[model samples]
Target chain A: MTVLEARDVSYQYSVGTPFQITALEHISFSVEKGELLAIIGHTGSGKSTLIQHFNALLKPTSGQILLYGKDINETKETARDARFKVGLCFQYPEYQLFESTVYKDIAFGPGNMGLSKEEIDARVRRAAAFVGLTEPMLEKSPFDLSGGEKRRVAIAGVMAMEPEVLIMDEPAAGLDPRGRRKILEMIENYRRQTGSTVIIVSHSMEDVASLAERILVLNHGKIARMGTVDEVFSHAEELQNMGLNIPQLTGIFTRLNQLGYGVNPLTYTVEQAKTEILRYLHKGGAADG
Target chain B: MENDSLIKFNDVSYRYESDTDTPLPLAIKNIDLDIRKGEFVAVLGHNGSGKSTLAKLANAILAPESGKIFVNGMDTSDESLEYEIRQTVGVVFQNPDNQIVATIVEEDVAFGPENLGIEPKEIRRRVDDALKSVGMYEYRFHEPHKLSGGQKQRVAIAGIMAMQTECIILDEPTAMLDPKGREEVMKAMQRLNKELGVTIVLITHYMDEAVKADRVIVMDSGRIVLDGTPRQVFAEEETIEKAGLELPDCAKLAHALKRSGVNMPSDILTPDEFVEAFQRCVSGGGVL
Candidate 1:
């Protein structure tokens, strides 16, 4: 079932005077429930602008976004409803954490939903646990926490609302390797538990290859390509033309193929490449069939 | 000049000002390092691992509470040499949107030279040269905000380049950019280091970027936990895991293969290296 769909969505930014910059044009795609989609593109490719339209953060200039087969802009109430259903976590979400304590920050979302005080508290605790935040850390000031911790708290704040469609923009930006891995693990765990539609905007091919079941390649505000991870990565030349890359492992496999090694041409992850290489080695190191 | 190191940290120890306990929270502890002229060094650490603090010390943004830091043979503790040290080592921070100041690209590039009180003609020459070096000369007249993130970062690097500094320290310059922007910025940094012979101290979280540097330094909990060429540093799986860091995916795969009794080298930093090493192992009479 299509949980969210955009029909010919287009957006324009007015710089000044009468002139306007078209950020996105003729964008169309549908995301199903429990699908983990990654949007990859170069800067100014309109990936962020398009994702903002998913939750009605920006009204389309020429088209419509349908959440559950209903146009979001049909009514203010509907748009507001869409906002809760689609929890949009902006880049550097830690900057949006304004509450004094982490608990208050996480509770802020559920509290705004007009839930019972007890229910809000329960939801906040559950959200914190989902993101791996400990009990002692909840009462402490958010500003006092480290960068990665603060990011998790902000993400929990959104998770407290229990949105159906979770959208994250570069959630691992500026994080170290361990922090990046921890956040990725938490996100996967949350997705498995909640089965929400997950759309992540990122630049790292490795991250996208690992987490995204479907890859959406956005170029100049248009739906350049959308397919499975293997299918998208197979168009390495096209992606490179759009100023993007296949995963580094893919590049290495391509190089090995060029050097007369009969390796599988469609490897996206290190494990796949390892398996293919080992298979070739086990076949008496044959160069070709 | 051959005997003199460009930058040296002698048992340097730093603690944040907020901590009051006897054993303060050390940002960097007992760091002893020597950086020669025109060396390209990449610093890797997870967040809060003291890599940024170490970069700041090179330009005197932060002083070591214990030990000494010498920049171009001048002690950073000497207040008199602060200006000289800062001018000798320029810093480019993470966010290009935040670091940029001027409306136009060329003017922003010229800001540093102007601050150094260079002559107007010299400033213009430096700015033009710097912009050209980073492949931003064509965008000199364009509004900086109108440019792409990668272009803006290149402009930021050009600003530092115009200062005519011997060393440039970039603290996660590509963290805020997309993969293409990252590629552009890394290429520009490599070009600056290769062509101009500028020493580069790049602090980054991306293992792929670190693989290209001549040397890699890993910091953890305010300590220089690992330092060597990328191959050497990435070879120590236990050290990397203990530091709360992940090896490059290729390195991880190599480690796994080694555990499975494959005779592959454990220090593979890139997919290309892994592919080459595996191919060689198969062809060089290795047991399957």
Candidate 2:
């Protein structure tokens, strides 16, 4: 089922002014239930603007967004409910952490949902665990925690709301390797546990290659391409022409193919590259006849 | 002085004051570092690992709680020489929005030199040269707010260049930018170093960016845990992992190939180097 759909959506910023700009135009895509979608684009490619429209944070100037087959703008209640169903976590969410304690911060979303105290408490604890926050740290001030810990708490705040479609914009930005892996794992765990649809807007091709089930390429406020990891990364020349990059591993294999090695050019992940090389070695250092 | 170090830290230690009378741990402690003149150095650290503290110490943003820091032979702790030190070593921060103060690109580029009370003609010349160096001369008339993040960051670099600083320290400048923006900023930094012989101290979390630097410094728990060339530092995968970092993907692949009994070097830093080594092996028929 299409949980979220944007039908010919277009958004304009500062409309009716000399500085008016069309941020997004004629954008159309549907996200299915329990799918992990990664949106990749350069800065100011309308990735952020498009995700903002997901939760009705920014309404399109033209066309409409549908949630579960009903136009979100059909009724104010539907629009309001869409916000709850599609939680949008902005970039650098840690900066938005203003609550005194980590526990309260995570609970803020559930509390806004008007859930019972016990239900809110349960969700808060669950969300914290998903992000690997220890119980003792929950009572401490969110301000005192390390950068990685604070980012997790902020992410947990959104996860507590239990949104059916979780959308995060550059959730792992500026984090170290361990922190990045932890957050990516937390997102994967959240999806597995809730079976929720996940949408991530990121600039890291490697992260997208590793995590996303399908990838969407945005360029100049339009849909440039959309496909699975291999399908998208295989179009390396096109992406480079658009000022984008393929995964380093994929690029290595592509060069190998150009150098007369028979390795698959679509090898985007490290594991696939490893397996392909091992197979070639096992085949007596020659392409299979 | 034999190495012509531009910045030096001697037993420097810093601790942030607690907000609620609860004692906080030291931010950076007992750090000794030397940055050579006209060298491009990359700092790698997790958050709160004292990399930012080190950058601030160079430009005198934060005073050392103990010991001393020297920028261009002047002590950073000396209030009398603060202005000269800041002028000598410029710092660019992560957010492009915060660094930009002017509405227009050329105006923002000229803000630093203008603050120094330079003549109008000299300011104009510096602004034009700086903007052109960063490849942002075409966007000089555009509003800074309307520019892309990469272009805004280049403008920030141009602002720094307009100051005629000998050294530039960037604290995660590419953290908020996309890949294209990152490439742009890195290219600008490289140009600044090569063309002007400006020393660069880039602190970044991205391993790929670190590959371009002449030397890499890894920080952990307020200490210099690893310091060497990119190839040397990244070859110590276990050490990097212990410091909460990772090898660049190309290096990881090369290591994996070596581990699986392929005769490959373990220190491949960039994709191009990896391709070259793999090609040699393939053509030489060493590793199928």
Structural similarity to truth (TM-score) of each candidate: 0.94, 0.96
Q: What is the interface RMSD of candidate 1, in Å?
A: 2.5
Clashes of each: 0, 0
Model 1, stretches more than 4 Å misplaced? A15-19, A258-262, A285-289, B1-3, B19-23, B128-151, B285-288
Tens digits of per-residue lDDT, candidate 2, A1-289, equal 8899999999998899877889998999999999999999877789889998988888999989989988887778888899899898988888899988999999999898879999999999999999999999999999989888999999999999999999999999889888998899999988988999999988888889999999999998999999999899989989877778999888888888887777788776667787888787677765432
Task: Calculate candidate 1's fnat.
Answer: 0.68
**Model 1, span A139-189: residue lDDT tens:** 999998999999999999999999999999999989987788789999999
TM-score of candidate 2's A chain against the true A chain: 0.97
Give the per-residue lDDT digits (tens) of candidate 1, residues B1-288. 645588999999998777435665788889999988888999988889998889888899888899999998899988889999999999998778888999999999999989999999999999998888676898898889877666788899889989989999999988867766688778878988899898999999888899999999988888888889988898888988898888877788787777766788877887767777877776675444
The CAPRI class of candidate 1 is: medium
Q: Which residue pairs collide in model 2, if any?
A: none
Q: Find the candidate with the highest TM-score and give its number.
A: 2
Q: Using DockQ as the measure, which candidate wins? A: 2
